[model samples]
Target: MAVATQTMTDEQRKSVALEYLKAFDNAGTTSTGGSILDLFAEDAQVMFPKWGLATGKKEIGQLFTDIGGTLTSIQHHYSEFTWIFSGSDLVVAEGTSHGEHRDGPWRAGVPEWGAGRWCDVFEIRDFLIQRCFIYLDPDYAGRDTARYPWLSQD
Candidate 1:
């Protein structure tokens, strides 16, 4: 995808940045696919913190499909967002991810208390994420597992 050079105003940039984030964050709650796709440009990249990375619309669509088929939900509350514009089309979003898994506490990615406070750095192009880097504190994951005490074998 061709990155744009339109030069958005500071406010417009922030607006676009928020929209870009809402696409993914909302996916964790009420998005099936279309809602999530709305925030992406035709070519986007979606990555799980430590699992997978899908590039382009086709790949991203499949990633969403896989997410829908396997895990029941992404339930999350996004707060503490800090956004910066790299250029007209590129943006980086740093925010804490906190949520719980309702159906299965045994799940690895799912947590008991919070969503592990992750930082997702998104490379947004044309209003969608073209690349992403997910960062999460393993200590939080460990703590969540510790709370349950039945699933941690390590």
Candidate 2:
């Protein structure tokens, strides 16, 4: 595996991170004409809520497949995205999204504290993502309300 060199500028790193998001939004489609995995380094690590941590490309592919299988569609609100640069390799992106899960659909701000809101912290270098940790509620359908008294329908 090629070593990741810290040669990309902040703007370039931001661009790569954005590209990852774009590819994720267009996943399983021919629009991007490329696999999302292409944006990651061979030894890249990824973390998703409930999915734990995945190391390397092979594990990352499995992680994506697991999550993608449950979502019918997803669209990130690019206009609402908030970006933070760490003056180094770290780039954080916070945004809202609307999507269809296997059970139902969800949109950010609908019911205030539901799904759709998310934040992802990424470490980019050599024009590829070296690490990405996603933070978000996975319950798109709000079916897990039973665990929270406030969210309970009854």
Candidate 3:
């Protein structure tokens, strides 16, 4: 982990948050997985509502890597994402990520594709993100599969 001795301020924290939004914008239709790291601190961790918890930059990176493999690449458009500043060292942002399949798991379903929204709580430190907890529902994927003949239930 890189050590940053600079004091973290609200302005710096907010500015750093933009990188996360930028990462989603740059992902385009292909899930690079690595780009999302811009949002987290090197030791940052995220706990998915159903997917479980992941820690460290490398681990978090790998988790998204698997996600990239499961679904076609899609850019996350975060609308209505705002930071709730908690003592300048913490901020929580909740928003939606909507995109269409361009590669894996959800394709061949509904002919209309799918999208999801996530709620995230972030813990910030030294102008870098230290932790993030994410919540999502893959129930939509199952629903899409059962409804689309092109998708295999198996």
Candidate 4:
């Protein structure tokens, strides 16, 4: 039996990765009615550390919606990204994200607000996101002091 898959050039892989990031940034700031989900294939999956695997568009959309509800604002800044092409259809992009999240309660006397880092791995196929595995310190949601003790002005 022969396995078949779609193929994308190196430039196409890079473009898809960038486009996915742009769509994510736009989604965070707009009300486009599930436009974020448009970046994924029909059977895409998202896997996060604590969030298990969200399969298909509906589940994935619900996952993002739930996460969006937790913060008033959030932003992902991709500082570095390294791409690896597996076969012609699979491209794995790994990167670190400098991010900010605010407007919640995650600590005993502190509002949930902090700037942290994230490590993400994205799998792209045919110009769409096929899978995304995100790894990060979810505990960083608490006091910034926990993660940024050097910021003290004392």
Candidate 4 segments exceeding 4 Å error: 1-6, 28-34, 103-115, 140-154
Q: Can you tell me which runs of candidate 2 are displaced by over 4 Å? A: 1-6, 28-32
Candidate 4 local lDDT, 1-154, one digit each (tens): 1122666677786676666665665654234344777777888888866678999989998888876655544445554566676655556665544334454423222332332445556667666778877766554454445447564433
Candidate 4 colliding pairs:
none
Our model 1 lands, by Cα RMSD against the true structure, at: 5.7
Q: What TM-score should be assigned to candidate 2? A: 0.93
TM-score for each predicted model, relative to the true structure: 0.59, 0.93, 0.65, 0.66
For model 2, state the Cα shift of residue 85 in Å: 0.4
Q: Global lDDT for candidate 2?
A: 0.88
RMSD of 2: 1.8
Scored by TM-score, the top model is 2
The TM-score, computed over Cα atoms with residue i paired to residue i, of candidate 3 is 0.65
Rank candidates, TM-score, best first. 2, 4, 3, 1
For lDDT, candidate 2 versus 4, the one ahead is 2
Which candidate would rank higher by lDDT, 2 or 3?
2
Tell me how many residue pairs clash in candidate 4.
0
lDDT of 3 by residue, 27-127 (tens): 51214365567667777887755567788878877776655545544444445676688885777766555444433233222334453555667667776
Candidate 3 ranges with C-alpha deviation above 4 Å: 1-4, 28-35, 101-115, 140-154
Please give the RMSD to the true structure for each candidate, in Å: 5.7, 1.8, 6.3, 6.3
Error of 3 at 43 (Å): 2.3
